[model samples]
Target: MEMSELTALLTPEGLRLLDALGTVETTDAAARAVSTLRAAGHGPDLVAAVVGQAHLRAKARTKFGEFASRMLFTRAGLEQATRLSVAARHAGRLRTAGITHVADLGCGIGGDSLAFAGAGLRVTAVDADEITAALTAFNLAPFGDDATVLHSTAETADLTGIDAVWLDPARRTAGHSETRRVAATDYSPSLDWAFDLATRMPVGIKLGPGHDRDQLPAESEAQWVSVDGSVVELVLWSGALARPGVHRAAMVVRGGHTHELTAPADSEDAPVRELGAFLHEPDGAVIRARLIGDVARHLEAGMLDEHIAYLTSDAALTSPFVQSFRVREVLPVTPKAISAALRAGEIGTLEIKKRGVDIDPATFRKKLTLRGPNAATLILARVGSKRHAILADRVDAA
Candidate 1:
């Protein structure tokens, strides 16, 4: 957005019009709303800003919930902004660690700052982008002076009196609508600088979940978090923020419930055993944290294959770290044979899950002629050197 457009949008008149418009659910509705506002004497810039904000606010609801209505966002900032629930977890960790004041470096739209303030911590939120810093200031307005948004690069931010540091470096090119990923070396303030700062003070560094584990600082505690079912981010905690005896951790958040597993070091993989009646699939966070073997050990399970992550056991036990399934039948791996077997079993509404295989679930589903009254999950995976298809029923966690 241009400076002129932003200046206009921050005005009382523009804000009133935007609030009056509320939310524009569809493009057709937005077009009609734009025409109505224009006919009512609103200028073109005001109309455009309000319309754009309406769409962004609607999209922000998934991340900020009701707070999205009161928030202003740039497309790229909103996309990179941490979800309110996830940010709250981060804030909770800081609060529990006795961190009262924090320096939020590269605070995008003040998502983490909002959470920190809400958790009763004084926050100094900094962002290199002027527009983003302005938006963050507006979003954090309710906190008064407790939340301060600064328009400055993280590398230049003065952290003299800050009790803790939270850095979310920009890992992508700057664009509101389109952005491309950049390397960690290209990150704003750079990972090297961030790590150096961590050595001097308690720090929480947020990075992509796929960040190289080999590059992580040995003294920091690395935690991988998954929201719902997708692995979202990897957080490295340094100094006092790093938990004792917790070098690796996986936190799985699903439907408001959180489950965490921590280990001092990577666990060894369980031995490969013959296929059992039950199959278990570890959550993505666990896999990313390399804690799958821990989950397998907890269930007294063994790997389906030496190299694959799939676990099997004779017991029908269930745990939060893994999704368990009860095996019903083992079928041939070929499409024709699998189709005949499924047809013979009168199966329909198939859920295809695969790992260690190159088959696209959508394309493979199209090849199968499924027509039956029954429904089941089909697991396609490699068992050592051979591919096997297992029909199973999902076992819900108790």
Candidate 2:
């Protein structure tokens, strides 16, 4: 079936069939939904979500599960995958911003919406797809009447007395391609329109982490958020929600690790401290937010390079964004030099880490035949034009 046909089938009939037969409490709903779509001879890829959604409804063993049902999942959601922790990261930002109420624009199956409610915030979840809206309503039912699920495009969604708006615009192009071809203006209307609507209320927009930095507003806080060390989504928070020039924030969700860094508004010099034999790389969010100065003070270290985000310290610093390693041996960045050291110590397996270097870790490892038991050393070398490798053991010191 064509894309338009698949979209049409998701209305009235498809929703009714799903509602009538999807109330079961098990993953078997997946098979049943697939059976229905197969019987209809619909595009298998098109209905794959229907199948997974069926399973999801049945898998609602927790309060959060009930909330996830209202969200709309795209092909990317399936491919890149969404988890409870990841969704909670976005919801946490809402809570941190002092938002007591939310308008969950494009609420896919209500995953993040549910999280907001679970975090004790009221929600108005909206979706253009009828089936998705129905699922959202059903999932949001446990939030009591405080949460409202609407069947409307983000453009027409009522925004009366809303505390905040969150939009995850569809980024995928037609034809199931991962790349987005729709111009910002082609988003049913335009991102500018969405931003205007948001300016009327507090708003948070979720975009691909690879989104163009040039297009972001001057006053917005563009945050590149990562959960468990992996960068997930780039978030745009308007001044309506948080004051402008709020240096971007990098949040590491797991372990509840957070580091706030801020640069001078006038681009003043970042105070450099002494290099204490160890360097730490701040998380992307911290670097983007220009919070390196604060991070340096937090770590009690100075900049190894005036502009680099790396922090150097001798005293063991316990920051989540920075890793601590003890330099076992500092050697030149050459195959022969590295090989000699590795063999002398009988270092067998090498964990190669390089920065500002062109040497491939795999190629370097293969050439060295890195073999040795027990401890290891770091090799510092310029891959092309700079010296930037540090061989170290994962020690307690920073």
How far does residue 188 in candidate 1 sit from its true spot (Å)? Answer: 0.5
Best by TM-score: 1
TM-score against native, each model: 0.97, 0.72
Task: Report the C-alpha lDDT of model 1 over 256-286, residue by residue, as the tens digit.
Answer: 9999999998888888999999999999999
| lDDT at 23, model 1 | 83
The alpha-carbon RMSD values of the candidates against the true structure, listed in the order shown, are: 1.3, 6.0
Q: How good is model 1 by TM-score?
A: 0.97
Where is model 1 more than 4 Å wrong at Cα?
none
Candidate 2: where are CA atoms >4 Å away? 1-74, 78-83, 86-100, 130-135, 174-189, 243-245, 256-276, 306-308, 375-384, 395-398
How do the residues 1-398 of candidate 2 rate in per-residue lDDT, one tens digit apiece? 23453464356665565555554455565666677778888666546645544554444433234433443343333333335666676677778878888998877667678778888889999978665566567667878978999989888987888888988775555322154556665654367876676566677887767676677776676766666566677777785665456636565554555444433231232566544566666666556555666767777777766745666777677476656565556666778887787788787766776555567777777777566575564544342345755666665422
What is the Cα-based lDDT of residue 126 in candidate 1? 97
Task: Specify the highest-lDDT model's number.
Answer: 1
Q: Where does candidate 1 have its weakest 10-residue lDDT segment?
A: 1-10
